[model samples]
Target chain A: MNEIMSILSYTFFQRALLCGIAISFSAALIGVILTLKNYSMIGHGLGEVGFAAIALALALNLPTYAVSIPIVIIAAIAIMIISQKKGEGADLIIALVASGALALGVIITAFTSGFGTDAYNYMFGSILTIGSADVILSIALTVISVGTYAFFYNRLFLVTFDESYAKARGIRVTLYQFLIALITALVVVIGMRMMGTLLISSLIIFPAIIAKRHTNSFKGMVFTSVFVSIACFIIGMFSAYFLNLPTGAGIVLIYMILSALSLATTKLLKL
Target chain B: MSLLEIKKLNVSYSNHYALEDIDLKIDEGEYVCLVGENGSGKSTLVKTIVGLKKQDSGTINLNIELGKVSYLAQFNLKDLNFPATAKEIIMTGTQKHGKLPFYSKKDKEVYKRVIEQLHIEDLQNRRIGDLSGGQKQRVLIARALISEPELLILDEPTAGLDYNITQEFYKILKQLNKENKLTIIMATHDIEELANDKPRIVYLSKKVVYDGNYDGWKGYEK
Candidate 1:
């Protein structure tokens, strides 16, 4: 407890906690919405786009956040357009886009060679990388995520449950679809820095799945996912600090354990 | 005044016409049953009326400016695994037009009226996945009706139900149409079943093959 309190007293550790919680909360909300639509791969795909955007920003000597955000948004909209076809076409488009963006990032990184930090740091995530600015951005994203969700909760529900019904009711299905894609892109870009592009999507996927195992209602799923995400992030950070594990790895480990436990609990409760 | 009118409408997918030069007009408080074989565009016509798909060329004038529509899509069209209580699902229908954060008091009252009308008040809090197939359909109908739509459109609402249940379902629709003066448009391929119900049947095979009296339409079918 004394050691842990010392870690919390550090400004860097505090920043990581603030950033992680905010990103995880938004990621979980976005995850539940996308998972309902069977578009979970969207998070992974957006992460790849985010990586490429950041690499490009580094190459151009521009601000990473400004450059990465717009590029990811554009890519997200493109994915939305391609995914409008749905089924095999949608899956193929996401796969193609994800692979292409990842390849582009790798190629860009090789040419620039000016990224000051090790690419390994971005790949696996290092809590030491989060700055005060990142903390602010993450908090802003949380506010945006919560506000967007609160205002559009019904429309999002209607769209996710029965899109045709939403369309027939005169709701702007395409607009809301774009809004979902846009917000998801924002979450992916911010999350990629802390959780790594390779693993950030897990932050979106795990919480929602874990929450689903524990609850049977959509609202319950959303709240549970948010709770699971924040709690896991905090515990994982602490575990990583104490046990000498990677932060993302520790968080994911905790998520995996809870997932298995929830599955078992659901079965035992039913029995 | 007719609640809906479609003139010279043509819709195509991949160079094949789903609906070709379609002409349709539905009136206030009238019940319309659209019948066609599979791929004959019964679903296409309903989709166009509800504005899901835009017409390639021609016009659809939905008469109601407010034009509130309650749509119960086919069973296969809805994602039943969606984790929402029956009440939450129903309440979302009323929240689309600027009612935000949560359902309002007026929304709650509308919900009460719909559930009382549908008599599925008990299923309100039950998870969607837990409801029986017939019960799911009832909840969907309640969701649609809670909006107090000027027109109610359904595509194969009776699919996957037993014969007795289908009849009972239609009986409720009939009562709503007769008593509440609600406009209804339903599309089904169940020729033998719905033809006996004697609603105005518009038979379509990519176009209006027959319109008006089902009695005369039977001769036309022969």
Candidate 2:
């Protein structure tokens, strides 16, 4: 018991606990917006882009997040630009570009000497190594993301419902779309540290999907998603601790289970 | 001077032309109805005018400028189950440009005026997702009008309403047009509704087949 208590008292575990909760809250709120707008894959696309840029940064041995910032931004901008006038087919282009980048990164990392074991931590996040700097970065991102969402809440709502209607009323739909993409990219970057490239989107999607079933309004959806995400993060982290399992997989599995339960409850209640 | 002028307008998807060589002019405060078969480009024209769809090759010279023309699509782009009140939907019109944390008092006043003007005061608090088809149409129209646009464009405004509701809607539109001096352009399937409001009519079937007054539509008998 003393050993377990001491482990929890360690700075690494404290950083992981704090950053994990904040990341899940921010990601889940944004996720509701993405899910409602049917842009669930945006997070996935961003995760792939983040992984590629991180791999490139590792090869160059640069500050990983700083080096990857421009790449993720470019990927996000490309996704928005390509999808502007096109239909669902644009999603295909986004997926292709993102997957190609990730695959390229994987190949590069595989060929590199030092990137062998280090790359696995990124592929599947290792929350055990979370540092104070990562925690500070996550806190900053959470503040920015949450603040921006609150500021543009109504306009975002209008754009989500109908871009044309929003434009007709002079909402600057393109500008808002660009801003959202940027923020989503930033969230993905931060979340990648805790959840990793493969599991980050689950942090965004599952909480949102479950909250959507239980909520009636956009505001309700946001609150519900944040709550679900925070709860899942705590439970998944503790469960991973007890079972000596991978934290990312544990969190995602718990999210999936919760989502399924939510769906079933909605059905039972005829919602 | 014409409120709107289109010269040699052509619309297409990929290679298939939807409208061809369409030249038309709308005067200020003129109520115009576009009657056309499906895919004949009635909705396409309105969409182009409102900047929703780009013209493949043509010029839309609006004396009123682009954003001053408000447009309502054939159907609400939002899902029917979306949780927004009628007032909130209508507010989207007036508050479009006034994004978060910057909503001015003047914008609220504009919304209040529009609510009063549209006579939807009673229905303001009702959830738009729960409204009937006719009511939804009215709410959307009210939203378009909230901006006080120089030109109001509606695509198939009464497409899904009951016969009686459609008639009543046309009457309301006629009254609103007269009272507000709103320049109204709409694509409608109900040719009979044109009889009550004697607006200028354009008959189309993949082209501008006819353009004249409602009573003098010579392309087809109503």
Candidate 3:
């Protein structure tokens, strides 16, 4: 207990906790929509695109987010366009793009000097290095994401469930789809700093699936996903601090365990 | 003026014509049934009317604005697993009213009225996935009616329903058309059962083979 308190006393740990919680909340909300649409893999694909952008930024000694955000957004739009075409599934397009981005990132890292350590930290995550600026950015992005969701909740729900019906109702299905993709891309870019490129998609997928096992309504699933994600982040952060484990992997493990518990409980209760 | 008008409309898939040179007109408060075999362009015509598909070369003139058309797509159980209550699903129909984040009192009243009208009050709070097929169809119809649309377009709504449920579903549609004077355009393959409703039939086999009452359709089919 004393050791946990001592870890919390550090400013970096405080920032990490705040950032993780905020990002998790936003990711889970986006995850519910994406997962229900069967576009969950887009999160992972965008993370890889962000990873590539981050590597390019590192090679150029530029700001990480400033470079990654715009590129990831473009990649997201490209994915949307490619997926919109007939005879091609979005998952297949996302897989192609994700593999391409991962390869590009690896190639960039191989050439960039002194990037090995930063790359390793980015991939595995080091919450100990989280700064105040990252916390502020995470909070700001979270507000944008959550606020956008709240404001357009009805439209998003309509588009996600039955886009054809939404279109006939004059809901501008394409515009809302683009908006979701943009928001998800931003969330992926911000999340990569704390959760790492390889593991960030877990933050966007696990909570929603876990909540889905227990809830029978969209609102219930969304609310429960946010709650579970925030709780998991907090507990996972504490465990990472006390157990001297990697933050991203530790949090993902916690989510896996909770997901298993949720699955079993739901089946047992027949909910 | 006709509530809906389609002239010289052509739709194709990979250069194979699905609907060719289709010309049709529907006036207000008309309960029109479009009947055809599979791949006979019944679905395509309705889809084009609702703006789901684009016409290759023609014009579709709707007297009412596009927003006033409510559509219930063909029943696909893929989205039945979506986590939404019947009430929530119905409430989304009010999205066309304004830009408010929440439904207005009038919107809520409409929702309530539709729920009552559809006799789905008991199922309002129930999850859509939990409802029986007939019950889900009622909820979807309620969703369509909540918008107070001038025209309601449904595509094979009773495709999977049993005979009793299908009859009940058609009865509700007939009531809406007669009592409320709601315009309806439905596409279905069950011409024999639907013929009893006395709806004006538009028979199509890639093109309109008959456009008249059921007796005329029977004569034309023979």
Candidate 4:
């Protein structure tokens, strides 16, 4: 109990809690849409691009989020464009891009002699390392994300369900598609600080899948996903502080356990 | 004035022409059925009209307001697993009604009317994926109708339905056309079943072979 109180008193722990909650909520909102559209893998692919950007930023002594965010946005748009072209396999294209970015990141890290500690921190994530700048940026982005989602909720629902019909109804399908990709890219980049590049995409995938197993409506799925993500993040952070486990892996393992329980319960109930 | 006009329209799929020199005009409240064999471009023509497919060289003049058009795509079994309720799916149709981020009171009224019109009140709260094929088709039709579109385009809406369900489906469409005067342009292969309506039939095999009453299509040959 004393240890818990002392941990909570630290500014780093408070920042991690705030950032983790915000990121998890933002990721849940974007994740439900992507998972339903069958574009969940794009999160993983864009995370790789963010990883490359972060490595490059570190090697050049530049601000990490400043460099990584813009590059991830560009890569996200590129993926959307490439996927939109007919007759081209979107999954294959995403795979090639993801692998290429991972290799680039690895090669850059190799050249930087003193990159071991920074690279390790990025790959596994350290909640104690989150700075005030990250906290402010994360909170601002979360607000924008929530606002965009609220304003475009109906239109996004239409596009996700029947894009062709949405187009016929004059919904500007392309614009909304790019908007979703952009929002997802932003969330993935900001989230990489605490979740790590290796497992960040899981935050986007697990919550949606677990909620989908329980909810039948789009609104229900989204609400359930956000709730599940926030709960998992808080519990994972606390468990990591007490158990001395890596924060990212701790959160992801909790997500896995929750997802397994959700799956089993859904099957038992025949839902 | 015609509600929709397409002139000199051409659509191709990688150097192979799917439709060429297609000219079509549909007036308000007209019931037009497009019939053709597989690869005859029946689907292509409807898709082009709905703005899902770009025309190679032509003009598609929609006389009505832009949002006054609605489409019901062909059913694919893969979409059966979509996590949405019938009511939620139907509510999406109201997106064309206004610029608001959410549905208004009027939108909700229209939704209620659509549910009653389609006799899908029981399925309103049911998950779409859990509904039967016939029930799902009615939900989709409701989605298309809730927009109150002057022109409703359907691409093989009854493709995989059973015989009785197909009959029921046609009945609802006929009621909408005759009673509500909703202009409907449908593409389907069920010519004999649709013979009772005496709808204008456009038979195509890469081009319009016949564009007249259904009885006239019997003599049409590619």
Candidate 5:
């Protein structure tokens, strides 16, 4: 308890904790919709795209998340449109874009001298470096995410549940699709800054899936996922502080442990 | 009164046309059984009527309010396991009434009335996957009927049901058509089974091949 308090005495630690909770909430919320819609990999897919966006931002000496958000959001919506046209082979489209973007980022990294080390920071993340700017952005994100969700919650439920039926009722299915993709892109970009491109998708994938095992309804799953995500983030941050571990890796490890335990409990109890 | 009129409608995908030069008209309180074979355009026609798919080149004239046309899509194998409950699913039907969440007094009334009307108050909280085939169909039908639509469009609604359940479902549709005076356009591959219901058949195979009552459809061929 003393150690955690000491860690919190530092402003950087305070920023990291605050930012992490905000990101986790939005990540889990978007995660439920993505997982239910079978778009889980879109997180990882956007992560790879974010990598290329970061590289481009670095090349132009611009702000990373700022540049990454628009590029990733566009890619997210484009992927959705292509998937709609291509039908159920969305996995293939996501794989194609992700691989292509990762390759492009890698090429840029190879060409830029003395930049590989900085890129490495983004790959694994350095959450201890969280600044006031990041904290402010995260808080803003939380407000936007919650507001967007509240405004469109019913329409989103209809689109996610029965898109064709929703469309037939004169609901704008395409517009909702765009809104989900847009929010997903925002969360992925912001999360990548704190958790890195490689591990951020896990934040979006694990909480909803874990919550799914425990909850029965969509609303239940959403609330449970947010709870699980925030809990995991705080615990994982504490462990990282105490054990001298990387925050991203520690959080993901905690997620894995929770997932295994959930599987085991469900199997044994037959619940 | 004509509820829907499709004039020279044509819908096509990449390689070939799914529906072509289709012309049809539906009147109020009519029960239309759209029968077709595999790869035929029964699903396509219904989707077009509901405006889910844009016609390549044609006109679709809907005399009724757009919200008055409810579409109950074919039951998906994947969606059966989805996490929505019967009550929640039924509430989604209220989406056409407005986009915001159900906060109005009238919205609650519609929801309560639909469940009571369907006699599905018992299945309200049950997961959709837990319901029997007939019960699932019942819930889906309730969803479509919740908006008090003037016309209901169902795509292969009885695809996976047992014979008895299918008969019971047809009886329900018959009741809706006769009592509520609701117009219906149900797409199905089970022509032989539907023959017993004796609805006005519009046999479609990329185009309208036949449009007549069961008596006139006695010896119709592809």
Candidate 6:
């Protein structure tokens, strides 16, 4: 208990903890919406885009956040436009765009910055060096994301269920869709710092899947996902501290394992 | 004057014309049944009328505006696994024009009335995914009624149901049509089933083959 308190009292550890919680809360909320809308793959693409933009910033020695904002938003808009075209095939487009962007980022890094140990850490995630600025950004983005969701809850629900029905009833399906995509891009941007590019999408998908297995209503699913995500973050971070494992990977693995167990529990109880 | 007009409408899918130069006009309160065989453009015409697919070159003028339509698309058209209750699903019909984040009491009352009218009050709490096929169709119909739409469009409203349940649904539809004087346009393949009622009938197979009395159209099909 004394050791745990000592770790918690450190400023860097406190910032890392706050950043992790904020990322988890926002990702789980948006993730439930994405899972319900059947757009889970978009998160994968957006996270990679944000990751690549950061890599480009690092390689060019520019402010990473400055270069990242426009690139991630553009990527989100481009994916939305591509998905709109008939036969564009969302899964293939996202996969191709993400892998291609990530590859370009790596090639640039190799040429400009040389192979470095920190690059691999960034690829996975390192909570050890997360600053207070990162924590504040995460909190601000999470608040904005969750606030938007609260205000547009019903509109989003209607649009996700039936686009034509929503349109007929005079709901702006396109507007809601764009709003959702925009928030998702923001979440991906902030989440990349805590979960890294590779495991970040899992932060958006796993808890939502667990929540879905237990609940039958949209509200129930969202709240359950948020709760599970927060719990996983705390447990995973503490366990990683003691086990000398990677913090982000530990959190992701904890989420995945608990999600599996939740699924099993729901089945056992026939929920 | 017609309440809705479709003049020289043409709908194509990747170079194949699904509906060709089709002209249609429906007056207010007319119960029109669109009949045809499979791949005969009946579904395409219905879809075009509902604005799901835009016509390549045509004009669709509606006196009641497009927002007033309540469409019950083909069963296969909806994603059944969607996470919502039957009542919640039905409530979406009213929420489009509703005030944000809350449903009005009048809207709630209308929903209640529709559920009672369609005998689906028991299924209000059930997930739409959990309902049987016939029950799902009934809930969809309830949803269409909740909005008190000026025009109700149904695309195969009775697909994947036993004969008794289909007839029961139409009987309920008939009651609502008479009580509310709601305009209805339905497309169905079961010509033998709806042959008795003399609703306006439009037969289309990529073109307007016939448009006149319903009873006379049945002879052409035979």
Q: Pick the candidate with the highest DockQ.
A: 1
lDDT digits (tens) for residues A188-260 of candidate 4 = 8888879888888888999998998888888898899999999999999898878899899999989989988
Model 6: clashing residue pairs? none
lDDT tens digits, residue span A96-185, model 1:
999999999889998997445756666677898899989998999999889888888878887888777777778888898888888898
**What C-alpha RMSD separates each model from the true structure?**
2.1, 3.4, 1.7, 1.8, 2.2, 2.3
In the range A149-233, model 2's lDDT, one tens digit per residue, is: 7778778878876676877665678887887787788878878877888888899889888876665566667788899899999
In candidate 4, the second chain superimposes onto the true chain B with a TM-score of 0.94
TM-score of chain A of each: 0.95, 0.94, 0.96, 0.96, 0.96, 0.95
Decide which is better by DockQ, 5 or 6: 5
Q: Which docking class does model 6 fall in?
A: acceptable
Write model 5 residue lDDT over A202-242, tens digit each, in one string. Answer: 99999998998876577788899999999999999888777
Q: Judged by TM-score relative to the true structure, which candidate is superior, 5 or 6?
A: 5
For model 1 the local lDDT of residue A92 reads 78
lDDT for model 5, on a 0 to 1 scale?
0.84
Candidates ranked by DockQ: 1, 4, 3, 5, 6, 2
Off by over 4 Å in 2: A1-9, A83-91, A94-99, A114-116, B7-13, B16-21, B56-59, B65-68, B76-85, B101-130, B160-162, B205-209, B218-222
List candidate 6 segments past 4 Å from native.
A84-88, A167-170, B77-81, B95-100
| TM-score quality measure for candidate 6 | 0.93
Query: By summed lDDT, which 10 consecutive residues of candidate 2 chain A come out lowest?
Result: A84-93
> lDDT score, residue A151, model 6?
78
Local distance difference test values of all predictions, in order: 0.84, 0.80, 0.86, 0.86, 0.84, 0.80
Model 2 Cα shift for residue A211 (angstroms):
2.0
| Model 6: how far residue A114 lies from native, Å | 2.5
The alpha-carbon lDDT assigned to residue B141 of candidate 3 equals 93
